[model samples]
Target: MRFTPVVALAAFTASTTASVASDRYIVHFADAASARAATHASQFAPTERRLSDAPRHLRSLAAGGEVFELGPDEASRVSALPGVDAVEEDLMFEPTTVVASLWKRQWYMHDPKVGVDAEKAWKYTRGAGAVVAVLDTGITPHPEFDGQLLPGYDFISDAGAARDGDGRDADPTDMGNWSDPGECHSPEGKASTWHGTHMAGLIAARAGNRPGIVGLAPEAKLIPVRVLGRCGGRSSDIADAIVWASGGDVPGVPTLARRADVINLSMGTTGACGPLLRRAIEQARSRGSVIVTSAGNDQKNANTNTPANCPGVVSVAALGRDGAMASYSNFGNVTLAAPGGHIGDRGADDILSTWDIGKRGRERSVFGYRGGTSVAAPQVAALVALMRSADPDITVDQVTQQLVDNARPLPGPCPKGCGAGLMDAGATVDAVVEDRGRY
Candidate 1:
């Protein structure tokens, strides 16, 4: 009744050790003249004589200040000086990489041959006003997602699988999906994936946040639709979520105020496309929602994978830094290929995004690297958002055609067949904007 996610992820290691040297402080003066005069005062003689160099003066500031190293005992002495307004610690600031090196680690957004070239695409549009629905294990709170998430629903019907006690509610927060030994047909227990959070970050993590990697469509809005959880989620629940996300009515569920322009399905099961899912996809497409799906990680014919194999969906295949089909990626029937990274011993090539540090419950937030067609699918979905933002009236068929027509051939080989080609974000957005006569 349920299917597990097709993803491979690794935890990022970080350190919180503090520096043990004397703290630096900035002494603010009531006026610039007072600051200048204080530099020569007897009260400052001790600090001037103790330090190797002169204090850095900030006389141009509205409340002029001076930055200098200060011992705890010396700090108290300076705080009591005449005309000194305030003396505060000069805090050290570093790049966001100190917490998580997502920006530097995101090679898929820059590399010319194999990457999506998202930077070049930004010249055209940032996907403002577009909405994308992420249907997966649900989302977790992260700084990168601040102010970008829309009110979402939890569609997991089974009480045990939902893991929050009772079935289905308004909250779509990921409660952690760690499973026991032999759970969900696995040989051993597994940690919570925090999958939907990662997918959402890849689609639209806030830009200019400085601490995390920028998403493909930084201005787009995300709807976190909870479908998979615990051992996995049922197909029926996923089907219902698809309809609800695209503005279709479901029994006992409130109508969605804003329909998503793109629906991202990053989880799938083996076997033929079932009628239940087919109808949902058809209904979503009829409402102008372009559906995107992962081709699976089973490394076989993707035609045997549901949803990916389903009609009326844009199925994506996984590619590594080499632009070849990933060793773990399923192939045939794929619509496009995108960077999914190959997880080797070092995991240096994996796609890095926002994540959680918890194993089975809520914990501190962090960024991590993940691989699989699940990761690759969101890249296409985000691109679809950009396309929609450029031309709000673009049809679903037009969106799919532009993606296929502008895709570039993979720089590496895919003997088993990958897709139309590798996704070229720059070229694809250019083509769409041009088609709308925006040139």
Candidate 2:
């Protein structure tokens, strides 16, 4: 009837120094008293003494049945204990691309010929204090974000497209965009791309973790506004999201607690901008938020694209790793080109970013490659964040001017209308510092 005394974790660590595996096990008990009275301390070694670096006294072996390191035999014995409920292994997750395979793949972020020079720009600013609203499919929980992700609004409006079977509330998690052939009028069924997740990673995935891809602006915050869904989001829903993301008021929707300094529209439709879209952009502009849109992947004149061609929008085109226009990227009216990958690259020259490797019932966080104007736009959005971090008072007009002024000509033959030229993150942030110094 003797009970094991609850001793300091350091003492427990020093007392039972048995060889053990790296697997940490969680043992659940029916009650704290049963755990405290149990004499299983010798069988199950205390793993993490402190509960996330809490005080020593609070990390006793009997302190709320904390985690323990146990081998197979030891774990089995512990599971058979009188009051033990269950035993499971503790798992760690690093949310980013596989760095070994990704270092060479992410040439779009560093290659001077076509990349955005994120390395140099990062030296200037990592986009701290700035917020970029991703108006795309929702976002999911991942380790790539170090508490910099904000709870964003889901403006799907249509329950069917939402796939979550709800119109919209505050949950912006991307429920896989999987769809049947007839769903959303697509010619064939397609798996979800986790588009928003990839975009968010590009804008600000946690940096210096030593495992995965680093973002252009690692310290920036992301506000994921889920406007697009299953097949494609309705323009009405997208317009509402734009308005709400910029801290503008929308009927029936709650007010945004924080406004975005920059809004990214990676999705777009063909034809001129409609009244609904125009009104939302106008309102967002009035609130001092800059809107950045993809120049469409249709390989046609971007002037035919809706939001890209919208007044006051900074439209972006795509460039391949070779410093040439991506074959699929639409031209004309483009603000500038960023690495979006070319069709000829197959998977070799695609933009590498964070993604989920699973489909349907088996979802796991992993990194993959994708190419399109959609991928290109986030590069600029991240650059804008760095600019905001450097000069909080910088206006949308100033962003446009700085980009135009600092752009370099295309390395090879330029397309019909590549706007100013290529997006130079180093030059852009330097220009901001220079402008501030002058003023």
Candidate 3:
């Protein structure tokens, strides 16, 4: 059995698209003032039939459920209300996965931490105080990440936060594998979830613990924010989670996410980072969180992946075990490459790690091998955490800059996609040391 990340509260069960009809509705108000007004209270007098389940507005509404979804006529009536704003319909799009991870057993890879001719840059740097939010599947509690989770929030349908809903918090093997309710007999094989969980382990798996796998940052804490579920959340939900994780707004959602210095978006949409995602990333950047994302799995040049392609994000490309760029990795503007491993093969696929260990109703063997750039993103994220531990107050931009500055450039057809170069923990540590000395 393969274990990745647990998606929704329902856990193992899957959902058929046709089975659930996504309710489409509209919100109308008197004027721009009323409509754009904060989620606190609608400025206009809402009609009885007009109701809403607006994510941000419910809090200020007197009865909480006072706001209702109304059709056109009701919208028209509400429009006549004193402070009506504009009326708009809610548009929901399917959610997508984002990721990158893994690193171990590579000799040529920079390891200034314990090398004969180790660089002096690492002595002064060690990822001081940066917080990287892992927004993929769910993170399993492993001996490696024992004390690594900082403060995680589950965006899986909003109810099962932290706890997997089985009354326990970290059940490694009980991840929800992806299975398109009606995917079979389609094109690809049956879909499943938990790919996120397995990805998480690759990046932060405990180091030096004599464990199943080694991570990029053995000491870095994880902030598990679950944004995926059975099927997935609409764009709205993902956008909300992105903003909230970076210390932005969401009405009903308590301020669980503090201001993180960095955020790891190991997920992406087939579509680009649309308006909502773009806006959310911009807002979060304004608040100061270094956002890192996986370039994409599409094997095409100039292939732009959402959030990854979004402005001001560090998009990582994937590399095979032997240092050649993974042909499948999306390349145009590759930032750098780290070993993401080759699926179902060894030597050619040394980048491996322990996967979901405790999912329910599944076969006992959850640990297995797989590879890709999705596995590489987290490797960088865990590195960010270690850098934070070394210096907690480091600015998001500064950390990102250091990463770019220190990465060992790779050789390839298009170096652009690989960014500064392959991420080297020891090299990065050395650069930080130099950075601290200059400071």
Candidate 4:
């Protein structure tokens, strides 16, 4: 079944009533001393709530910092303070999914014009010794991942959202995200997306061994972390997933033996990146994890999409078969573009990846075609895996820089905001192997 575009997370709580502005504000100070000074200051003291979850390493942005109820005037005043590094209005967010038609072939990964050059790039490296974390709806036991899958955990904190009748367990199986009509407060029900399965297949489905489509990184290992579920997942849950996937601790969750070299976030919210998410992303980066996220499919500027809009992520845009930007893909913050596949080209033009068969509860192994920025982000993530394989010590910044510098120019409407242009897998691998950064 084709997946619907994901609704925005609850983080975007704005009203059309111009008279009533958001009063909640988040302030980031330059240091602990500054945060303490600001918290005690007459202006900040009266309104600060002192309720935050950020860790000590995060400094002023952590729990040590303070959240406040403030009007626009006061927010502006705080933004101008020398001690305040940044001040933003507290808001909610939602995840965006790209729309696509269903197809059953894997031609999108083979075609040169619109596809990533995975074949040639594979010659340089099959992404050995690299681990990719798929932070979405967990994975099913598909043969395409015989020896490529790694031990993973389910990070869905809410038992109802997990749908497995439990809260946060180690089992990362996809129990099906199918929902009854209005089950998730929706006007209509949704089919189990099996989104993580599709993404894992694209990144590292076994090559030349099985009857299924070959993944971009045949030798790379995949770590599935279930975040999205039932109706959708919470942004807070996703934040913790990011930290855990990058080999960081999450209080009670068990520590992972292997840390991810590349973290693929095919999902995100629509509002500004909250401090919780920003903290997770920064921590992941500090551990040398290259983060890749979808640019969204709202047909608007991607700079407005969280996680993608957040700094330190390689935000991806979707390209169609005609080598143009997909009509639904978000732009602006795109770090690079990839074949998200286009609709109306029949099934031949859409991205073909692993999927499941049967209705919800009775799912089986299968492959299908779909397109969206979600499809595009995994392509970038896989390439990063290859880059990491080529140079095991590569940093997050280096991998992103290599992709941007070696990208081929776009041939369509996107000139600037669509990133450096389409991703060239072969060239990107070559650059990494040659150690181009030193030059």
lDDT of every predicted structure (CA atoms)? 0.83, 0.79, 0.55, 0.78
Highest TM-score scorer: 1
Off by over 4 Å in 1: 1-101, 344-346, 437-439
Candidate 4 lDDT score relative to the true structure: 0.78
Looking at candidate 4, the ten consecutive residues that score lowest on lDDT are 4-13
How does model 3 score by TM-score? 0.63
- Winning model by lDDT: 1
Tens digits of per-residue lDDT for model 3 on 1-439?
A: 3221122201211221122222333544433334344223433333331233122233223322223344344334443434333444455665331111223343223333211111232354333345567777665555556666676665655333222554222222325535443643355434344565566665455544243554555444556776665545456766777787788867666674467666777666576668888888888888877777887777765245777788878788777655667777777765666656565454524445555443432333334566677777777776666666666656667777878877765633444456677777666766665566455
Name the lDDT value of residue 91 in candidate 2. 66
Residue-level lDDT of model 2, residues 1-439, one tens digit each, is: 5323334322434543445443466766667765554435433544564222211122234444556655555556556655567766656878554333355667877786887877777777889999999999888777777687987989998888887878988898888788877766777888887899999988988745456677788889999889888788888898889999999988988898889999999988888998889989989988989999999999899999989988899899988778888888899878988888865434878887888875642278878788899999999999999999999999888888898888788875554777888999998998898787464
Give the TM-score ranking, best first.
Answer: 1, 2, 4, 3
RMSD of 1: 16.2
Give, for candidate 2, the lowest lDDT window spanning 10 residues. 50-59
Model 4 CA lDDT for position 64: 45
Candidate 2 residue runs with Cα over 4 Å from true position: 1-101, 208-210, 344-346, 437-439
TM-score (all chains, Cα) for each model: 0.77, 0.76, 0.63, 0.74
